[model samples]
Target: MRTLEALATGTPLVASDYGLEGLSVDSPGTPLGAMRANDVDEYVYAVGRLFQDEKLQEKLSNNGRALIENEYAWEQMTQRYEQVLLDTCSKYLVESQE
Candidate 1:
């Protein structure tokens, strides 16, 4: 949730891969400039890199914000949830009638 907030606010991110499983932020073909930190050392290194590289920080910040705006905005996420709830309720209603 905090990550979403950060992304929404255009903050550059360095997060754990496990925390970003479905988003594919650090995976192959990831569109965002986010870096993944697997451990403490990597986390430190990633933070240092961001601090040292202004261009990289800017790229990551922009990409993170764009990604959220495109795919994970509150309105989009809520619509998806509403669809899931409606679908599940419809399915159960049909099954119960049988």
Candidate 2:
């Protein structure tokens, strides 16, 4: 989350996919930096890629921020949770009636 947030902020970030499970970032052995056993190489390469290729990094950073801001806002997230909980409880009540 932090790495993604950093990326979203246009701040330099390095991340291993392990910490950010389920979110696959296609770049290094990890997502951004040192997470692999030979992470040093992957890390250097990933960061270097960002420095060397400004456009790609900018795209990722903007995309990341847009994603979180639009899709993962706490209000929206909690609404999803509330809907799920309400549905589950409703189902439980219906089944209990039987």
Candidate 3:
């Protein structure tokens, strides 16, 4: 979920609308950006676009790596879980909150 959010915040995505279904962001595509890869062909097309186009590669590289750094990174993800637990306990005031 966090990765998706990060990706959305960055470059275009090649994912199914169903893949995007039940998510927060409404618009995930742009005129020359984010696309849906519901099948092998769409995926190949999107990837081809990335490779054949230098700008696309730059976009994917920058955005995808940023996603990894910001969300998929082990330390960052761990922090999210830790914060969730702390927030839950703080809200409920449980003895185990410590």
Tell me how candidate 1 scores on lDDT.
Answer: 0.85
- Local accuracy of candidate 3 as per-residue lDDT tens digits, 23-72: 33334462233455788888999878877887876666565556456546
Poorest stretch of ten by lDDT in candidate 1: 19-28
Badly placed stretches (over 4 Å) of model 1 are none
Superposition TM-score, candidate 2 onto the true structure: 0.68
Winner on lDDT (1 vs 2) = 1
Best by the lDDT measure? 1
Expressed as tens digits, the lDDT of each residue in 16-77 for candidate 2 is: 65654565444445233222223788888877877888776766666556656665678878
The parts of candidate 2 lying over 4 Å away from their true place are 7-13, 24-38
TM-score of each: 0.84, 0.68, 0.52
Backbone collisions counted per model: 0, 1, 2
Q: Return the top candidate by TM-score.
A: 1
Clash count, predicted structure 1: 0
Better of 2 and 3 by lDDT: 3
Candidate 3 lDDT trough over 10 residues, lowest sum = 24-33
